[model samples]
Target: MSGQQPGRAGNPQVFQPLAADDPTTVAGYRLAAKLGAGGMGKVYLSYTPGGRPVAIKVIRPEFGEDPEFRRRFAQEVQSAQRVQGLFTAPVIDADTDGAQPWLATAYVPGPSLADAVVAHGALPVEAVLLLIAGMAEALHVIHGAGIVHRDLKPSNVLLAADGPRVIDFGIAYAADATSLTGSGVTIGTPSFMAPEQAAGRKVTPATDIFALGQVAAYAATGTPAFGEGTSHGVLYRIVHEQPDLSGVPERLTELVTRCLAKDPEARPTIAEVIRLCQTANAETVLRRPEDWLPSSVAADITVRAAAPAPVQTPPPPAAAPAVAYSPTAPVAPATPPPGFGPPQQQPVQPPVQRPGTPVPPAQQPPRPYPAPPAHAHAYAPTPFPAHQHQQQHPQPYPGAPVPPKSGGKRGVFIALAAAVIFTVAGSATAYVLQKDDGQQKQGSGGSAQGAEQGKGNDTTAAGGAAAGSAKPNAKADPKPADFKAINLTAGYHLTLGDDDVRPQQGEDGGYELSYDTGGYLDAETSEGNLVLLDPGQEGSLAVCRAETRFAKNIYLTKLAKGRQICVSTGTGHMGLVTVQGFSPEGSPSEYMTLDVTVWRNAVGTGSGSRS
Candidate 1:
């Protein structure tokens, strides 16, 4: 909100200092202050190594592990790099493989066309003509690269001192890939949608042109070509009705009309639109010496440009942690609230400590796993209660089956039968023998009696039998990772797919694994990265790669069978984890029983597609 006057400095409401939690530097560039924040990540004003200002966007941490999101993000970023147009914000640098990926673009210091429309009702006929030509030129470059902007609207167009700059083209699908969207489903902003896009039909370069028509009409009429309403109603109008371009200027109406045609074939190409604009206003130039923006908007931009950049100092160099990880570190259950600790099929059973093994720290950073229902091992006709004070457990995991009691009863019967046979044989000997033989028979009979009597108080043998019967409980020893299968919910999944993370047993009967993101992930950023923690350094994503490569890759050491992988997400929480058996009828995530011990203040963000 700063403004400057002749012979005076600008006011001080232009920019503010960084927040307490904001990172000082990102991907080697020192940050000054925030530009904006969105669901994806925060945008900050940073400078390249050479000191020219840039707008850097840091993706939210949870997106790092989403396979689908990562695929889309990588494809879009690569496409963005190929675009070099006069009316577009050019991408300068990016780290698509980092834990929390980020990209930097040449900063365009201006308000969006949406803001301009809100402030000043409708632009003059000359301004509307200029807007069309500039956007067409931008689309020409974008379509030339075999990419579709998908969502093109007034909010995505910025009006700078020079001209309008089209921004945010990173959501389009890969030009060469097939669609992952469900049949008859559409993807885009509603009000500005093209008819074909709204109907879930195939889109082409002309799809953007249709949106271009709406943008131009809005700039001229100060409202949408399609009447405003709910998303469904708006979409219905786009597909079934003609555009109401009643308020667009007469001189530009014909061109806008052609762009808004229901059929893609009826739309004019970007090149043709530019030629018509040139014919309408031969003097139009992107770099017009005269101020082109509305008076109030131009004054605001002038004041903002005159303000000084926020002061920033370089962060201190940081030393790296240990170069190696201890595979022998004690294993534990993977906790779900903040981690996938150990599986909780039954009540949490304490792990018996073994001597001489170095135990990992008791606490670790939290993961995005959810805790299994309290009656995790039990099966019933009704759904398990999650918020109740007590839980009923009637069964254990099949992996730890309870042995039959009939076997113990059979052993006792066999022992008693042997004692009776010995007594009968001694009595027969007594009848057949004389005095000396009778004495031997008596001794034998006494021994038989002693053996039968011993059964009454055979506490030692009974104790052994009781221990044998408890073998079912003994099956509970394997840690979370020791389970055979794991599934995830729709909202939660690892970048490494099910096949990639399944521990493979080699010919040598040991887990054989390569430390990589199977076929889908980037080795540069994931080599040692743990999903439950922040990328150690923004300057370099490889800081924690060494520690997490094996974990991320699902390499199980003999020691890892019960290994406790402690995770630390930048969010304040610790995750204790163990994995076990899965339910038969639910999703992988739902049945993937994890023993999770969330620390005192675990966050609740992992249950959905985090941001």
Candidate 2:
């Protein structure tokens, strides 16, 4: 395996300096710098004792506290260690019993498929073919070890000089083990999920095949096959709509389509996918060319592979203060590190005085660490403040007299007198114009009704007609009443039928409510109809009346805050449920809170609506 050299110069863009809260060393290996962070943990660049570089992933402390997660994590690490192939990064070491579990993998110094595509557009057809073949081989090895990589996306694949390397098995699980869906959290990326995976059904090796199709399409084209939007919208399309493969090259279209089949049984296996790639290339063994990647992309990989400088820990303060630390105590201000953290405020200083003049009270000396210069690295050590470089003025001749002030007080008085005269003259002109306008109105009509008509005409001519016309309509369309906020949990059922709109626990089937994985809330009764509104649809009774189709389940995973959902109850009442917020992620007591507004009358009698 190729890796970065430990003694080379670093590129600030690739390797950020360690943060104040970041640890300098984990176990026996010394952390060189921060690589990046993800939802579950932070990845750091480190060197082995033999001077070969490795990437260490430290799991988040919250996840470490969960006993179930710890058990699953250890099992996954053991399985990942078994996966060995030419196109995969192998797990080198791990410690699952520590306070914070961490695993180390051989670091492949190259830009990810996602970053490369974003930086240099889509890859050529030849490059994409190689990518698919390499990824399919890696998946074969992973599945051979009885593991399923639940989260497979473009970001997890790295582009190496030799071939593509698949990395990051952080969420993989044994194929026969129980899933984590019981906790109401779906595990895979929304855009690349298979139909069964999006519906929270059984995920098999076929699930990764569906993701492989999406990845190939993305590599050939610059956008996702299902297109991009909210997670709810993307997942819905993946489950119900056909993928958009318009930009996919004609030669690879059929094979990619087969892998994306909605039915898992219909999709091809990993072995067959490899066969198709070989057939398309017309080679029993696809050999890579000397210039496999585009010139621009290869140049970018070369720049990122350059090793970064080792992080130097700042020395501790020479004399410590005697104050004890407390959680509630006000924190003393410290200078922010070079490139990251909030910007520091420069102190306000008094104006400079002449040498002969008495100085005002002197302010405290400037802070030892000054604000960083523009474009500094986020994690670099703070540099010393630059010396003041202001050029000094030559001293005046000893006997020379100071120049006299020019028009000091008299000029100010004249300007004020001129402004007063202009103000009086302007006010007189305005009074004459007002008097003339009144005379014209009186001459035109003497009756109050006629004068009012004349005023209306003038207002219309001045483009203020909408203001006069809009008031009555606004008054006629008053917002509906009976709005209530309901809190729903796993065992609760939210009833939108009567005046009272509250969630009840353990109701019968007619009024039952169940929350499932992928943000699905099921109201499994024959009485009411539910429809998730389209993006930007207004949340109102009228929208519910116009909705012709209703669903048994509503996916709220990607619904934006304040987005509306239309629903009709068994009691012939219509309502719009707005998502207020959800419980903190990974919380044991996970729940969703909704603000529902119900109307007494039901409108259209389409599919799910009650007459």
Candidate 3:
């Protein structure tokens, strides 16, 4: 977080200022404002003359002129540019060769995974699964490009509104980049680094996989595999000791252990990691888990600078058949290709010069049409048959398809349909091939085979603490004859019972519910029930009972012992379930921790269904 401060000396709001007033600007862009800064450098708010905001980071003076650092920086940028991913921050522009080297990309606003954890706590199992799968998918892409994100940890991950996004590629490299450190200098986090990394061995995709494992463990248990220790002690443990996974859920321990393995070759490949994560029943990780989403998939993220807040006009629904990029426009279109969306909304425009003003011809506008947004352009037409199009049209890529007047409409229809079909098929094929390639390199089946070869561990929580009692708030009325039947009206509806009551409300403004097993609800006494509640909030909430088969399969008595049963949403909100014990005579006793959960929600969705 320590870096050069740009503006005033003592104000928190006076961050580095960017050059936004002039078109031909500073930092290789029309600087707008300071975005954020870190230990290495300051990221500025800049834009193409066309008005696309790019997060531009200029190297500190200390490192910019260092020949070694510059060479490495150049190589790193090249490697980063080759990575294609939905969950990773992609390079939009950079100039490592400049006087003051800098790297720039699309600015994403969100809390880091580290911030999320520190602010909230451990995420629920489903959120952890999604995090793992998304990071794995990103790694698969980086690996495919012959690069590895050597520094893969929670601090470098952004939990954006859309999903998880891996950022900060300063330490990423090609598969064979020269080592950046001395023999004894460590390059990664001690708690999450692979054994090989700790041993100072060459890093690889497996190393990242191992780091991801530690990230997952931390996500589930609010702690890392190696726990707290001195750097040397942590390294030693990573190299020679076993991870203390007593607190980790049964379903996640195997994966985390494999990731912490001393032999890097033994770890699962990125694809294999995704497969296990996808196959694993995340429900067993937390009770009453939230729904999951693929955070790794690239989203059409549009971040605009707030000024008078210029309005963007979307492109026409259909464009006349033409080349994707026109000679007049070399900039990539903001919108994806046809079938993705209506024509893209172009980047914001600068003030127009008056008719009598002598504006430089170089600064002349390309096309009057505004471009579409990012997702709209992600699937943009790959350049068409360039030579053929040029030779046929001599004018614009569109008007060149000269029509025999009457047959014009039919010709355009056939061409447009072909373009849509081709784009769709190509995208699908690429996704499948990429997925397969990732699995092959990581040897995922080996771990699954190991899992199958090993005997399954008992996952039942010890002590029958299935019956729970209502703890009336200190402000509430005296204990009701039967809290369950008393309509304990406070501010919200409270549903409580062993019977499968349709999703109801709670005492708070949010939906509230509490249930117990009793003879009155013998029919509802099957293992567990799926309580799906749509609070008419942002999204619905779901709660699964402990008696359910999936819940029993992943919960461990050891993990639940003396601990409260809690589940979290992907958005990082957690709720605790009380654990009540029972005697042989059917008398319910005070609650003592022994409850288990299979699934929970992740962090950062809208408001909760239940408070």
What residue runs in model 3 are displaced by over 4 Å at the alpha carbon?
1-26, 30-35, 170-187, 282-611
TM-scores across all candidates? 0.46, 0.48, 0.43
Give the distance in Å from residue 115's predicted Cα in candidate 2 to where it truly belongs: 0.5
- Decoy 3 TM-score against native: 0.43
lDDT of 1: 0.52
Error of 3 at 17 (Å): 7.3
* lDDT of every model, 2 decimals: 0.52, 0.63, 0.47
Candidate 3 residue-wise lDDT, 93-126, digit = tens: 7777777767777655444566556656778777
| Candidate 1 Cα outliers beyond 4 Å, as residue runs | 1-17, 172-187, 282-289, 306-311, 314-611
Model 1, 362-439: lDDT tens digits are 221111112335564222112112211112221133223323431333323332333233233232222222211112
What's the CA RMSD for each of the models?
A: 27.2, 27.7, 27.4
Q: Best-fitting candidate, measured by lDDT?
A: 2
Give the candidate order by descending TM-score.
2, 1, 3
The weakest ten consecutive residues by lDDT in model 1 span 1-10
Model 3: how far residue 186 lies from native, Å: 9.0
Candidate 3 global CA lDDT score: 0.47
- Reference-based lDDT, residue 187, model 1: 33
Candidate number that wins on lDDT, 1 or 2 = 2
| Candidate 2: tens digits of C-alpha lDDT, residues 201-294 | 9988888899999999999998899999998999999999999999999878987899999999999998899888888888787877535789
